[model samples]
Target: MDEVRVFPIIITKNKDSSEYPYFVEIPDIDGMTEGKSIADAMKMAEDYIGTFSLENKLPDSNTKLPRVEEGAVVTLVSVNVSEYKRKNDNRVVKKTISIPNYLNELGKENRINFSEVMTAALKKKLSV
Candidate 1:
């Protein structure tokens, strides 16, 4: 099957800060061999669907998976989000932020530039 025939995967930011090269996992398939990233995962899915069709003796074309027969319990697989930000800091985008009064006061007391303090805070939060 072509990449277009496979179910679309969702991508999300990882919450675990300790890990570098922020990674995402796919959950719909029995195993996570497919759909593990925004780009690579999509490619993997295409490969997987193609392999599945070949193994099942189906035409090697983009086609929806056939539904199970009636009276059989179908185990629906839930699609999971897959994506990760690149490990490199070059991916970072600069943005101006408005600091709250309390935060601004804290930065002033700490002898920190308001923007610098906020940038540090963001860096800590993002673990970059």
Candidate 2:
């Protein structure tokens, strides 16, 4: 597992959005994403961090979060990229696959899991 990292964030209230009022951004990161509440913003920030490759972020003295204004808040958010990948990469996606009728029938008769078998075969073929 990669070491857990804490990213500082600035959360600004959005008067323009009644539903999702929190606007969150990571100082060490380049983009901003929004959420409905403080907690939502925190989760969104973690996910946002997860979406970027490690090359995009570097912690330095310059990463010190900006001071919060009256309607804004500053906080630290933690994300373990390896843990996030472990938790998220297992999502199963529906895929339409084709096989020879004889092969399909043989697998069906033998009671095979198409999805699991296909995933394994793909992983082997792709060297993943």
Best by lDDT: 2
Count of steric clashes across candidates, in order: 0, 0
Residues 4-53 of candidate 1: C-alpha lDDT, one tens digit per residue: 23342333334453333223222334323433344554455445534443
On TM-score, the candidate that comes out on top is 2
Candidate 1 pairs with clashing backbones: none
The TM-scores, one per candidate, come to: 0.26, 0.63
Superposed model 1: Cα runs more than 4 Å off: 1-6, 10-31, 34-36, 57-128
Instruction: Give lDDT tens digits, candidate 2, residues 1-128.
Output: 47577778889999999988999977786769999989999999888887663435445323356777787888888888777766557567899988999999999999999988998999899787
Question: Please, what is the whole-model Cα lDDT of each candidate in the order they appear?
Answer: 0.41, 0.80
